[model samples]
Target: MFEQKATEWVNSYSDMLYRYALPRVSDSDVAKDLVQETFLAAWRNIKTFKGEISEKNWLFTILKNKIIDHYRKAVNRLTDSFPGMADDDPYFEEGGHWAKETQPKEWGVDYNNPIEAKEFYEVLEKCKSKLKEMQNAVFTMKYMEGMESEEICKELNITPSNYWVLLHRAKVQLRACLEKNWFVK
Candidate 1:
């Protein structure tokens, strides 16, 4: 009986689930795996699904948690030995202060306005994609998902020091990329 209902979910929700997972995981194979795992988990807990929410929303909620788990595992597996910047880090001077020549230029942004330039988010995503795996995961977890520092540290199996370093480096790289692609140009 439940088997039949689960099968119906595959037919009804797999594509939508895949679409949702792909952009978040940024990989087709991982997205497919997540969708399959979602269904399997749903099957195991099928008795607990009380239909308070629509089946689609229930499945989607399960899949979202699965995706977060996938990222957590991937981040745990990654080494925290971030690469050096090869001495061209424009944001800092020799003494670690903001470089006068490289201070961020003011943008003509309207803070009072509700909307921003659409291209800003596009460029930000592009910048995010260029980050290293661990940096990307940490950045997304902290800023995008609004996870706490301790939660991120625990999820990634990283020390607090390591988490701060990754966040700093991700910010530096993202700022440089956005300035080059969006602000400076």
Candidate 2:
């Protein structure tokens, strides 16, 4: 009986689950795999499923954990220093002055227009893809996942000061990228 119900979930929830996972993981194949894994996990844990939360919410929670696990594995794959991060660092020069080329350009974003907002988010995702591994992890955790700073620090095993630095660097890089790409007239 439970197996039949779980199979039905695959038909109904797969599209919604795939859409949610795609943007978060930023890879279609991985997103699809994660959704599949989520369904499998739900099946394995079916005995524990309580009707308290909507089934949709339960599936989403499982997918969220799968995404986090992906990030954790990605973090382990990254080296202590990545080559692109240093060369791509736009915030400061070796002498500690701000980089002139990275100064933010004026963007004519019409926040009231849904179309412009959609465009902005598209560019933002591209910018996010360019972030350093650690910076990407920390930024997504705090902003995308809505995690607290303390929680991010604990999960990523970094100090509070380091978390702030990563977040600041992510913002600066993302802003510069957006200015150059989306804001260009």
Candidate 3:
């Protein structure tokens, strides 16, 4: 009875679980792991889940715990991971709380004007040059490469705290630089 229930639960809830998990983890692999782990955990503890909560609520509660576990493990792994040059490094991982809430979208730049393009690139180049080496790298890795804090931390051999500080400073510097260089026009 327990096996049948667990199997049916998996069939019903796996997709729902993934919908929640994938957005948090961003990587399909990690999302899959989280979903599978959530189910296994639910299977083990399902009996303990009092009738006060519905099965969906209980499963989701378990999923939430699993997500938190991922965050804690990722934090621990990131804290300890250094000289970790693999492309798979968690440095740029997207699941951290520090990850951007808003994804970049097409902000229609009027690119038809050759002079405008040149001027824009020139201003950006000036802004780029003004940043400290680490700031420049972080900004490039973030804005250009679109890496998340987790991956950037791993890639740059820095902690999450360091990553966020660099990003904040980089944004401030770039904004000031752009205002000085470009907004004048």
Model 3 lDDT-worst window of ten: 82-91
Question: Candidate 2 — number of clashing residue pairs?
Answer: 0
Residue-by-residue lDDT tens digits, candidate 2, 1-185: 86688678988999999988877776689999999999999888978998899999999999989988887777667667532345445578777678787656667766576554677788878888788767887888888889999988777677787778788888888888877877784
Q: Which candidate achieves the best lDDT against the true structure?
A: 2
Cα deviation of 116, candidate 3, in Å: 31
TM-scores, in order shown? 0.73, 0.84, 0.46
Better of 1 and 3 by lDDT: 1
The TM-score of candidate 3 is 0.46
lDDT of 1 at 3: 66
Q: Residue 117 CA error for candidate 3 (Å)?
A: 28
**Clashes per candidate, residues 3 or more apart or on different chains:** 0, 0, 10
Residue-level error in angstroms, candidate 3, position 66: 1.1
lDDT string, candidate 1, 36-149, tens digits = 999999888978989999989999989878877987777656564544324455578888887886677775666587447777776777787788767777777787668899
Evaluation by TM-score, superior candidate among 2 and 3: 2
Please report the TM-score between candidate 1 and the true structure.
Answer: 0.73
**Candidate topping TM-score:** 2
